[model samples]
Target: MSKFTLRFNTIAAALALSGLFATNLAVAEDIRVISSGGFAQAYKNLASAYEKSSSDKLISGWGPSMGTTTNAIPVRMARGENIDVVIMVGDSLDTLMKEGKLVAGSKVVLANSLIACAVKTGNAKPDISTVEGLKQAFLQARTVAYSDSASGEYIKHQLMKKLGIAEQMQGKAAQIPATPVGEIIAHGEADFGCQQRSELLPVAGIDIVGLLPQEVQLSTPFSAAIVSGSKVQKNAQALLDFLSSEKNAGVIAETGLEPVAAKK
Candidate 1:
């Protein structure tokens, strides 16, 4: 072949390769995610694994599944922050979908979180194995702390009332906002701390007593959904799939949550 033709073919090949690289770069998106504390630990572990195996990038943020705090996911959505995926309570996700904040049919259950109690690491563990025992534990504690999220709401509105100690707990029990209950207990700000087992596990200087008794247990479903206005819907869906996949069930379970993927 003529040298001119050979040089021209080489140039054409280089252009084609450059175009392919650009397409690949476009396909790998930076997906922004906001995860509630209930699923944060497990999501972090799974996200690390996903990042290692895929070219897509994840930008993570934390907030309560339901709250009016400045950092709350719903409040962030209301402020029109750019987000791609949300990992939060199932009911809260449903509320967002009803409000048209999340894409329809994009919700996926990741795990079930059970309410649990904790105390400072060196403090005596309370007996919460039975309904009455839990009540007594709460009534006896000088000060109690719970999250401002789903588990805290349950403790404040339903569980305490069901235990017939709502009146007694009125002054003693306080809802901790924008912070984990375990942290409160760890700091000795409260004698007893109550929140999702998964949320408690991540905090240091606290000993998780145990899950709430079956009679008064509240099992919250932690779910993930794509934000309605996300520019990277496909990448967001992939992340949700990775989080709820059977392959990640062990990691989810290790974080003190019941993996919904395993149940399926």
Candidate 2:
């Protein structure tokens, strides 16, 4: 072959190989996520922006931090489901790590939440400005509801006891399963609802009654963790890093969660 022909063929091969590599870099790979409703909107907004900014795609799953139902993150993990990352209540993530379900040292606080109350729209909002007022509101409502999530569990097992009205609410109160308490209230299935502020804000026709009194309210912190043996560890870590950054504070707050102090 002529020298020129040989050189031309070699250059073409190199260019083709480089083009293949570049195409691979531009295509985003899927990263799986399991997040509770408490912080679902924040992660969703961040994930959408992350996809636009780069080639890392997000495949998400929704579930509560703790529950026995199919949508519970812990239940899904225990059943051998595959996921790249988990966003859940902080203490629940700690429990999963202790049980060897998540990678050690992979947990990072994402945001803090307040357990808040809501009532149907166009209705007179209840008075929960004081501990006595909260208890009275609970007692006064004909039907009240809470979720099957961590916040619901807290209100059911702890807050009820604190208010000294647990027994009185037994028949009048309902425990909603894997659904937003705000949803139940909005539909008029329940006259009153209590859940994480983040969960409540997204539902329409529910008038937020504000956070419960400090004396009987819960300040729940949330976190994210890397799932063990995830197929997309590097990408998953990047997503976590973005969610935990201080720059995302405004978006996080818009979802009704308070951003924790950015890590040093």
Candidate 3:
């Protein structure tokens, strides 16, 4: 071939590549996400992998699924925060959807989180293998910390009542607001702490004792949904799909949660 023809062909190929790059850049989106502590670790793990493989980007924020705290997902939504996606407790997500805060038909269960107890690192691990043992542990703890979210609500009300220790745990067992229960225990502010296992695992300086006894165990569903009126609905749905995909189940399980298989 002639030298001019070869040069023209190379330039054409370069222009095509440049156009393709620009198209990708144009299609890329920044999906804003707010996740409660229970699913944060798993969402983070899977998000990293998704970002590496896709042109989309994820901007994450943390909060509790149901609380009046300033950073709580519901509070943020009420204040009109610009969030595209929300990962939180399944029941909370349903409530939000019913209230029209989240897009209907967008909810997807990502994992099932079990309530667990923890103590400061190097501290004695208490046996909570039986209903009686769990009651004894709570009774023995001088100061117990639980979350300000769902698990905490259960511990403060139902669990204590069920164990017939509600009166005894009155002032000593308190909900730690907007903070992980594990953090309170790690700081030695509380002798025992209880919260979702996934939330506990992310905090350093704490050793998870074990899950709550089967009879009193609370298996909370952690789920994701797109925020209502989000400008980037398509991108938000893509993120939800990535998070609930079967391929990422192992990652979610590694974070101390039981991954829920995505519905077909």
Candidate 4:
């Protein structure tokens, strides 16, 4: 072969290999996040944007009681699962901080949630305009539902007792196990169910009633933190920052969660 031809072929091979390397680099790094039902939808939405802007894949592991209000970080830590980031209740994060599971400086409240009620799609939307109306609706519900998670526990301990229906709701009210609380209503197995606003929005076949009245509402702040000794510390922090940004607030609101306002 001619020397000129040999040089051209060698240059072509070098360019092709370099192009392959560049393509691989353009793909994002996959980072695993452990989150509970409350912030799952919001975080998933933020993950899409983060992946596009930063070359890293956001992998989320969702648990019903795993990171939910009642169980929080302790369950995951006990289970010994590999988690890069945790998104759960603020109180739960504080517990982890006490245990040194979450890095101290990395914790941030991403969103706050209010409990809301849901019914099967196409069902008559119950009147929850007033506390009295909500009380009536709860009493009238043939089979009410609530979670065994944080919000559920609150409903049982505080709300029901306050409403004077803890005994009335005893046998008729269904306590959902590990499944999504909204699922029970969506499947027509329960007349009504309550869960975090963010959790109910993503679920299909369920229509959300507005949040509980302010007087009776339960607001649970959802926070995120990088787990201590996480391998992908930078990537996990990026995901948390992205979720906490103003740009992501729209999605957060759409999912039935309110973004934590920036402190002055």
Candidate 5:
């Protein structure tokens, strides 16, 4: 071929390649995910990065993994809502697996979520370092709020019992559903609040006092699973991969989530 002809052919190939790249960028898939507040921030971190890398859009919803309330993920699944993936407290995800709402062999631990205590940004940070301190904070606060999740359930049932202030907390504590406890405190609706640390870290206008004392602490592992019959199974798995990557460890930690140890 002549030099001019060769140059023209190369230019044509370059244009074709550019067109393919543009098409890939424009062709996007929507991956719908439902997870509890505990894992929402970490999931958001993964979703925002995944969208850029995969050219897929993420549609995420927040709620408890299981509950009698309409906002629960289990309730949404029962209503036949389409979901590509679920990130929630582990035992609840196990219930989905048992009920066949999620595919078998798709469950993976993402992180261990621990509970946190918070007060409004301008308020004095209360010490919850001891069991007595935790009890004092609740007894002294005018209003206390907690997520109506497993962590919250523990606070309502076990923690209150341990503190021996179960009766005192009655009517004084509020259970915030489908929302973070830190947010309620931030809004000044509640003078004291506790929720999953990951959920609290992302909310503005709140100061995280600290993790609950070991004597009254409750931690649950947050996990991800592909929803059964999802059309975007492959894409959902891609999101899980991004969340589980070693590079995301720092991001996860910053949100008060303990990265899951790699399985042997």
Candidate 6:
């Protein structure tokens, strides 16, 4: 071949290779999502669907309790984790936005879940339908377990106070150190366990008692947002979009969470 022709062919091949590389880079950017345990299972279902439908983006690590074993998602952000997106208690996300950890105006309300009690699948499901019924159930249990998360915190302080039984519950009620609340109940370590409805439903060997009555039921709205300095903003936003969709909302509802009143 002529020298000039050889040079032209090499240049053409180099340009082609560069174009392919860029295309792959664009398509392979996966969204990094950190979320609370309540939404993990439902979000995983949606992530699978989204990934199957897209070529330019993927949903990556769905970190349920991403901060670590000890810290909440907000605390994780304060500790300098590079989270592209976070799904957490809505109000907590608001505080993070105010503190400049998350991008302002980027919050998306995803779903809401309420706290409920569960017992081992074969155990008699206690009636906690009314305020008095709840008190009776609490009094009857040999050991009750709740977590350190939002729902657990509320039960420890608010519910016990409402029933005027904080002092009485001091020894009988235990603050659970970690999750799988239902699993704890299943093992008979706790006569009853309480946590967000979604988190409790999928756990093995537990039967969920109905949600707390309206007078005492606690509903927590969960929201999502991208971190202000995330380099993977595009990928993160794609994840947010998928999670906020109506189709995914149905899946969330089926999994025991209520859909958010409005999308962001």
Q: Could you say which candidate leads in TM-score?
A: 1
Q: Which stretches in model 3 have alpha-carbon errors above 4 Å?
A: 1-26, 262-264
Candidate 5: residue 102 Cα off by (Å): 0.5
Give the TM-score (vs. native) of candidate 3.
0.89
What is residue 35's positional error in candidate 3, in angstroms?
0.1
Candidate with more favorable, higher TM-score: 1 or 6: 1
Best by lDDT: 1
Clashing pairs in 5: none
RMSD of each: 2.8, 3.4, 3.9, 5.9, 4.7, 4.7
Question: lDDT per residue, candidate 3, 1-264, as tens digits?
Answer: 999999999999999999998976536689899999999988888887877767888998999988899999999999999999999998988999999999989998888989999989998888999999899999999999999998998898899999999999989999999978888998999989899998999899999999999999999999899988998898788888888888888888999999887334
Better of 1 and 2 by lDDT: 1
The digit string of per-residue lDDT tens for model 2 on 146-262 reads 988888899889999998999999998888888788889988999988999999998999899989898777888999989988877777777888889888888898999989854
The TM-scores, one per candidate, come to 0.91, 0.89, 0.89, 0.83, 0.85, 0.84
lDDT of each: 0.91, 0.88, 0.90, 0.81, 0.86, 0.80
* TM-score of model number 1: 0.91
TM-score, candidate 2, is 0.89
Candidate ordering by lDDT (highest first): 1, 3, 2, 5, 4, 6
Question: After TM-score superposition, what is the CA distance of residue 7 in candidate 5 from its true location, in Å?
Answer: 22
Query: Cα deviation of 173 in candidate 5 (Å)?
Result: 1.4
Pick the winner on lDDT between candidates 1 and 3: 1
Q: Where does candidate 4 clash, by residue pair?
A: 28-55, 28-56, 29-55, 29-56, 29-57
Q: Per-residue alpha-carbon lDDT of model 4 for 161-218, expressed as tens digits?
A: 8788889888888767667878888888898889888888888999998889898999
